[model samples]
Target: MPKQLFHHFNKYLELTEEHFQEILPFFEIRILKKKEVLMEAGNMCTHNHFVLEGCLHMFFLNDKGTERTVQFAIENWWITDDLAYLNQTTTDFSIQAVENTRLLTITHDKQGQLLKEFPQLEKYFRTIYQISYGAALVKMRYLFGLTKEEIYFHFTEQFPLFAQRVPQYLIASFLGLTPEYVSEIRAKKRS
Candidate 1:
């Protein structure tokens, strides 16, 4: 585990150096290049990845063969097909790196063993999951309540770094807008 992993855990719970060291053995560091697929659709998702650096997005191809990006995980954030990972089943989603990314990944078996051994980690994970769920709810509210342009503005306002670091096309996919519409919105802002 890296120093960043320690800091990420510390944000949720007070983990002593000794406790953190014990937890490190359960995680492995994996690196991916830009556009690399970490996990492809139709496979069983075995690992939950926490981004130590760079960005990753979870997406699926819709009926029309258009990529629909549903989630992104940046530094200190986690990404996985939750239902698939939890049930140890195949998934319809793929996770891809948007940039060169370093991740701390834990296998499902190891995560289970770790949580059993370290009860404190259960609290940490619980907090993380609760916050993640809340964020999903909020994202849904924004997606439904706001107009497409308003959604873009809200997304940019909420995650300014994503607006800058991620390509407009990917952002547009995530926001359910076309790249051309995103361009128009940018031009509107400029004017």
Candidate 2:
């Protein structure tokens, strides 16, 4: 693992060398095959994952059994069932590997211990949650108000790599559109 990944943590809080060493020991590296489920609805989320490579998606199945993607996390991103993780209850969402993925996982118990042992880690996580919350709020607003074409363009502009890696159907679900609508939008954009 490139120590550079730690820079994401450093952005929010200053970690002393000793603190970093203490925190590092608590994280375990995990690899997942594509389509593997990390956390499923009705199961407690045991760990929070920081992606080192590939993509993961958080989604819930509708009453009709269709998957509605709520969020996608690519390399250098974090993914977890935030509500379940914090409440220590069953998750409503499912988190799955969209591609073969490398992740650094920190268990809830270990994370709590890390907070007590290294206050800097607490500060880092607080900042991360704040950003995640804000982004989710914006995405919800856009999904309610924007057209499929607008959503596609916005996502492509902000996360071109994700647009390239994720399948169009998944992107359509994220945008609250059908696959045909997504295909139509892409065709229009190309012309």
Candidate 3:
């Protein structure tokens, strides 16, 4: 678990043994069953979860009572409602386990303590957030200008393993398209 954590941080910044040791105690490992909701709308998000294995989705229910998937985090990714977790407010999104998943969760309070205890580690987290923010912006641009087929192709190219691992319907939701349309696109691609 520490190895996974170490690698995840390394993607952003190098952490020394002392810095890692300071942040290590704040994390707790959690196992989640498929379809389990880790966070719900209207509740404060207490933990930022790092995926060790399997998948999780962050989504919201639309007025039409449909699930609109905002993000999917597979192995080595992180999931959290940033607004709620950082500000201590209720979340508008729900995070659920899409498959049997192992995760490391760090609480908001502990994260603050970590920053104070190991200032160098703060650079790692800042880099992570900057990357996440940039990705979100790219996604928004795609959503605004791209067709469903283009978006699906982009998703496939970006996350080929997830394309195979996740269910088609969930992928459709993530792409903001109907399952039938997504199926048609997939069929066309295969031929």
What TM-score goes with each of the models?
A: 0.97, 0.93, 0.93
- Each prediction's whole-model lDDT (CA): 0.94, 0.85, 0.88
Model 2 TM-score (2 dp) = 0.93
What digit string (tens of lDDT, one per residue) describes model 1 on residues 1-191? Answer: 38888898899889999988898999999999999999999999999999999999999999999999999999999999988999999999999999999999999999999999988889888898899999999999999999999999999999999998999999999999999999999999999
lDDT of 3 by residue, 14-62 (tens): 7776777767889999999999999999898888999998899999999
lDDT of 2 by residue, 94-142 (tens): 9889999899998889988878877767777888889999998999888
After superposition, the stretches of candidate 1 with alpha carbons farther than 4 Å from their true spots are none
lDDT of 1: 0.94
How far in Å is the alpha carbon of 151 misplaced in model 3? Answer: 1.6
Winning candidate number (lDDT): 1
Model 2 local distance difference test score: 0.85
The alpha-carbon lDDT assigned to residue 147 of candidate 2 equals 74
Worst 10 residues of 1 by lDDT: 1-10
Mark the 10 consecutive residues where model 3 has the least summed lDDT: 14-23
